[model samples]
Target: MNKVLLQWALFSFMFGLALSLPLAAIHYQKNSSFKGIFTNYRKLKSAHLDYFMQALSAAFVYLIGFAAHIEFAAYILIPFIFGVILNPTILLLEATPYIRSGWIRFIYRCLRATSPASLLFAWLAIAFLFLPTYMTIILLAVILISGIGILTFLIKRRSRNEVGVKITEIE
Candidate 1:
């Protein structure tokens, strides 16, 4: 098979495994049951962890595709991962109310739970898979700059929420 297709398969097989963790966590944590097919929530949870490792391995294999060039890798990975990203975003938002630690805990849980870095790395892998000429400096700049901006916004929001918590403690 060609590089992109090969990598896609690897990603689906292995990275798909690791991909299961955050998805499974969100699912099990949100729902007490998985339509009763699992019969045990613990099994459901363990299965998520299992998928997570597989996904990671798949991603590693997929990165090899970055060494070559493909016409539409970026568009492909983006659409492919859209639901993957959304699933956790929605799940985390749902758990915010139930989470006990407030903003800090919420942020921490999200950072741990969603795995944005992995997503970015997937993009980087996309970069690698494509021809080096196709991966422009501009694209790298955009990714890094956007990451910083988003990180800054999150930190500020969390700190602002924290001040309210401090005031409550004083009172």
Candidate 2:
């Protein structure tokens, strides 16, 4: 088992468990004052869920790598660790009122943009390490196609938005 991944998994799980305390407090308590502690309840909930998901993903990666006898390099594992930790943290920060503008907001936007790409690269790298060559090629092709499709959809949506064209108008 990779010690780094295992340690991060444990940390993420413990952090997630810790977050449940405040979540439960806000959930069960009827006091509006207490509920006001978090500005965005939805984002807080998303952060809580994401933490647990990241924990599980890290553990799964660790277990699979162990079973496959694949030793992951620092480059591969660094991105995975960074993404797992930062993704939920971004949501957690967004739930608060502190990061609204200025340099902090700029930094937050950069992190938000980077986290997904890091995780994608880490997962693809790990998959290539463990899976057979043919499967890796297939996986890469699927990912590329899916990315292109999503990009096309987003581009069309953006153009529609710029033209002030509503979905109802199109229909």
Candidate 3:
């Protein structure tokens, strides 16, 4: 298995394990003061889960690549690592009130928006690296279709927002 990928998996797992202490404390209301640190329990729980899932995903990819005798480049692994780390981190930040508005919220949204693309690219790159040509083609087609759908949704949402702004300006 790729050492880097394995390391990331281990890191994610350990981080999740560490995070669970505070989560459990908050869940059981062990310390009322501790609960004040994280106002949103649900987001904290989600972040905890995301970390575990991301760890599993990293491990799964590493195992599959090892079994296929496919060696992944370090650069190709960047997106996966970025997504796995930042995705849960964003959730963790959301658990606090600091991410509610201003530049922090904008940055949070930017990170959130980019995470799906990073994950998709990482997985698709892995598929292309190991899978047969026919399977890779099929996967590429599906990804393209999904990308188009997401692009369309984003465009529509932007246009609606623009229209709303214009209407408010005219009033």
Q: Per-residue CA lDDT of candidate 1, range 1-171, in tens?
A: 234444444443454366355557556587634333334444444444434443454454445544433334554455335423333433334333333466756665665555555555655665555536545677778879999999999999999999999999999
Which tens-of-lDDT digit does each residue in 108-135 have in candidate 3? 9999898877987888787777789999
Candidate 3 deviant stretches above 4 angstroms: 101-110, 147-171
For candidate 2, lDDT tens digit of each residue in 1-171? 377898998899888888887777788876755466678888888988899999999999999888878778998999999999988989987887767878878878988899888998999888888889899889989989999999999999999886776665777
Return the candidate ranking by TM-score, descending. 2, 3, 1
List the candidate 1 regions with Cα displacement exceeding 4 Å.
3-123, 129-135
Against the hidden reference, what TM-scores do the models get? 0.34, 0.84, 0.77
Q: Is candidate 1 or candidate 2 better by lDDT?
A: 2
Q: What local lDDT score does residue 69 receive in model 2, on the 0 to 100 scale?
A: 82
Which prediction has the highest TM-score against the true structure? 2
lDDT value for model 1 = 0.51
After TM-score superposition, the amount by which residue 119's alpha carbon in candidate 1 deviates from its true location, in angstroms, is: 6.4
Q: What is the Cα-based lDDT of residue 2 in candidate 3?
A: 77
Model 3, residue 93: distance off in Å is: 1.2
What shift in Å separates residue 59 of candidate 3 from its native position after superposition?
Answer: 1.0
